[model samples]
Target: MSTRLRIALDAMGGDHAPDMVVDGADIARERCPNVDFLFVGDEQRINALLDARPALKAISQVRHTADVVAMDAKPSVALRSGRGSSMRLAIDAVASGEAASVVSAGNTGALMAMAKFVLKTLPGIDRPAIASMLPTMRGDCVMLDLGANLECDADNLVQFAVLGTVFAQTVLGLLEPTIGLLNVGSEEQKGHEAIRTAASALRATPLARNFHGFVEGTDIAAGTVDVVVTDGFTGNVALKTAEGTGKLFGEFLRRTFQSSLLAKLGYLLARTAFNKLRQRMDPRRYNGAMFLGLQGVCVKSHGGTDGLGFANAICVAVDLVQHGFNEKIRKELALLQESLQAASAAASGSDPQAVAQ
Candidate 1:
C-alpha cells in the first residue's frame, strides 16, 4: 500500500481532455505539495503533456489505458461497456485501496452509476446524494441531492440532512451547522407529507437544535441555513435556475456598461469592484460536486470546465481525504441511529423495526 496520499484522476473524462486534465494536475500539485496523483488514461497522451511539466511528472504516475467514456454515454450503457474506460478505472482505484479518492470530469449519470455500483453506500445510508457548496449572502452554504435521487422519502431526506451537516462541518468548518429542509414555504403545512415528516423527525432528534424548521427558495441565496436538504428533482431545478439567473444578471450588467459613453466611463472607474464580483461569482471556484453517503470519496467536476476549475475539483477531493470526511460521517450517522432507536423504543415499546420503518 502506498503511504502517500494518492488521488485517482480520470484524465480523459472532460471536454478538453488529456491537456486540460494534465494542466489541472500540475496546478493542483502546486497547491497541495503533499498529494500525489494517479493519472488513468492514455499513457502516451498523458505523458506528452506531462513531459513539459517535469515538476508535475515527478509526483504523478500515468496508468496506461486507451479506452475513454463518451460524454454523452448513458449510465446503463457506460456501466455495461466502459469497464476499461478512464472514469471507471479511476473509481476502481479507490475501491481497490490504491487511491484515497477519485475525481472525474465526465458524464454525471455514468459517474454516479459506476461509483454507486462499485463503492456502495455507507453503513447507515440507503442512497447517496450529490452535494456542492453554493455561494450565499452570509457565506458558503452546503446543498445536497443536487441530482442524485429524483424522488426521496422522508427517511431519505433526513439522511441528506445528516450528510449535508457533516459536509459543512468537515469542509466548511462549521461548528454546529444549521440545517433546513427546502420547501414551498416556511409554514409547517406547506409541503407534502414527506417533507413534513422529515422535518418532524429532525426536530425530535438530538440534532433538533441545529434544525431550522423549513426554508423557501429565496432562503437558499439569503443563507437562511448553513445546510439545505431536498429531493434531487427540486434541488436540480433550483440549481439550474440559480445558474440561469446569474448568467442573465451578468448579461444585463454587460449591456448596461456598454449602453453609453457615460456608462463606459463609470465602468472604467468601477472596474475593480466589478472584477471582485466576477471573481466571487466565477463558476470555476465551485466546480466539485461530492457524492455523499458513499463508502469512498468521489468528486464530479464539470465536463466543460477549464484547468483552473478542474484544479478546484482536485482540491475538494484532497480536502475530503485529509479531513477524514467519511469517518466523521460514519460517526455522526451512528449517533443519529442510536438517537432514533432510543426514541422509537420509548414510543413503540422496544420495537427496533419501527425505527427502521
Candidate 2:
C-alpha cells in the first residue's frame, strides 16, 4: 500500500487481447492516475492499436517483445522458448521487481508453471491455485484451483480452504470467511477420502471454528459458503458449467424476446434492470483470475479477452497487491496450521471421526 502499483500486462495473451488489454489499461489509467501500466506484446500491432485510437494514445507504451507462446504450447517448452512472449515477460517483470503484479489471459498451464517457477509457493503451500469469484445466492464465493492442479489430496484441499479464507478476507473483504469442502452432499461422510480427511482436519483446527461444514453444488451461488475449496478437476468443471449456463441462458432470453413484438416491448422496459443484472452476473465483470499462494499476485484473464477484460484483470492484480493478499494468505495459513497441530495433540486420545461427525 505504500508504493504505487504497476501492472505488467500480457497484451496478446487472451481471446480478446490487444484491444481488450489496451482498453482495460486505458480505463485503469483514467480511473486511477496513481496506477501505471506496461503492456508486453508485439510492438507494431500494439502501437498500431494505440495510434488508431486517440483515447489510448496518451497512455504508456507497450514493452515491445516478439515471443508468443501458443495457447496449446506445453508449459515447460513455453517456459524455455516463450522468450519474449508477452505472458512470460510479464511474469518475469514481476519477479525482477520491475512490476508489482502481472496479468495475462494466455495459457493457464503455462501461467501456473511460469508463476511457480518465478514466484514459488509460500512456505506452507504445495502449489499455487487459481482462485476465481463465482456468483452465489447470498452474494459471491471465491473458488480455488479452478484449473491449476488437477489431483489434490486432503492436505492440498485443507491448504486451499485456509488460503481461500485469507483471499476472501483481503480481496473480498469478508471477515471470518466461511470455508467449505465442496462435495456432492451435505452429509459429513458425503465425499471421498480427501474430502473426509480434509473436513476432519479443518474442523479440528482453531481456524476450523471459522470454517463451516460441507456444501453442495447448489450452494455455490446461494452464498451458503464464502470460500469453496476443491481439486482443479471439480473446480474447472464448476467454472465452465457456470459460464456455459450463463451464456446459454442469455442467448435463450435474447432469442425468446426476438420472437415477438410483445417480448421486445417487455425487454425495452426492463432493459436497465436487465443490464444491471447482466453486469452483476457477467464473467467480464469478474474477469481476473488470481494465482493464490504465491509471493506476489498474478492474474490471468481469458485469452480471447478484450482490452477491457484484460485491463480489468490488471486492476484486480493491483487491488490484490494493495490488499496484501499474499502476506495475508501466509499469516492465515500459519494460524490454521498451528491450530490444527495443537488440536491434534490435545485430542490424541480422542476419537476423530466421532468428533468430526
Candidate 3:
C-alpha cells in the first residue's frame, strides 16, 4: 500500500527479453530502493523470473501482454498496429498516470512514434528530440535530435537549444550551459541557411549569453560547449561516427597488446590504467536516450545492452522524473516566450511576424 515512484517497463522488448528486464529491475532496485515497477509483457515468463528475485517481485506487478514490436519493424507499421504491444502498454501506463515514467530497450523509432502519439508534445515544442549525454575530456556533454527529425527549420533548431539547455541543467547540473550549433566549420559564415538563421535567432534571446556559435565535429569531443545542437540527420551521423571511432580504437589497443610478448608485458604493467580506461569508456554508463518534449517521461535503453545497461537507463528515467524535468522545461520555455514577446513589443511595436526575424 506504499506510495512509491513507479516505472513501467516493456518487459519483452529487448534482445534478451523478460530475463534481461527482470534482472535489470533487480539491479535498479538496489540503486533506487524507493522505486516500484509495472512490468508489461508475457505474464508467465516475467513471473517466473520475478519469483526468483523475491525482493524485486515484492515491489513489482506484471500486466500480461503478448504482442511485441519487432526490432526491425518500420515505425509507421508499428505505430498503426502496435496498440496491444508491451511497448505500447508500458507507455500507456505513464499516459494514464499509473506510472511516473516508462523505460524500454525496445525499437527506438517505434518508441518515439508511440510516445509522441500517446503523450503528445509539450506546448511550443513542435517535435520531441532524442537526447543523451556523451563522455568528453572536460566532462559529459548533452546532444539532441539524434535521429528524430532529420530535417529541421530555424525554429526547430531553436527549440532544440531550449530543450538541450534544460536537459543539461536538470540532468548534467550545468549552470548556464554553453550552447553550440554543430557545423562543418566554426565560422559564422559557414553552414547552410537553416544553421545561419538559427544562430541569428539564438543571438536575439537570453540564451545568447551562453550560445557559443557554430561548433565543428571535433568540438564535440573537445567539450567546447556543454550542449551540441544539430538536425537529426547530422546528429545521428555524428553519434554513430563517434561510437565507431571508440570501437576502432578499442580494437587497435587490444591488437597492439597481443601483438608481442613485450607488448603483453607492457599491458600487464599498465593493467590498472587499462582497467580505468575501460571503465571510463564503458557504454553502459550512457545507455539511456531520453525522448524529450513529450508530455510524459520515456527513456529508451539500448536493445543490445545487458542488465547493467538497462538498469542505467532506468536510473536515467528516475533522475528526470525526480528532478521534475518536464516542469523545469515548461518554466524555462515560458520565460523564454515572455522574453521574446517583450523584445518583439519593444522592437516592432508588437508585430508578431517581426519576431521571427
* Model 3 regions lying over 4 Å from their true place: 1-3, 350-357
| C-alpha lDDT of all candidate models, in order | 0.94, 0.83, 0.94
Q: List the residue pairs that clash in candidate 3.
A: none
Error of 1 at 244 (Å): 0.7
Segments in model 1 whose C-alpha atoms lie over 4 Å from true places: 1-3, 350-357
What digit string (tens of lDDT, one per residue) describes model 2 on residues 1-357? 545667888888866667777787887777656677777999888898778767656656578888877889899998888866788888888889988889888898988888888888898899889999888778888999898989999889888887888889877898888888889999987989988998988877766777788888888878888999999999999989989988999999999989999999999999999999988987777888898988877998877666666667777787888888887777777887777766776679565555677
Ranking by TM-score: 1, 3, 2
Count of backbone clashes for each model? 0, 18, 0
TM-score, candidate 2, is 0.91
Q: Tens-digit lDDT track for model 1 on 1-357?
A: 545799999999989998888889899998987889999999998999999999999999989899988999999999999999999999999999999999999999999999999999999999999999999999999999999999999999999999999999989999999999999999998999999999999987877999998999999999999999999999999998998999999999999999999999999999999999999999999899999999999999999999999999999999999999999999999999998978878787866766579
Q: What is the TM-score of each candidate against the true structure?
A: 0.97, 0.91, 0.96
Candidate 2 lowest-lDDT run of ten: 52-61
Candidate 3, residues 222-328, lDDT tens digits: the string is 99999999999999999989999999999999999999999999999999998998998899998999999999999999999999999999999999999999999
**Worst ten in a row by lDDT for model 1:** 347-356
lDDT of 1: 0.94
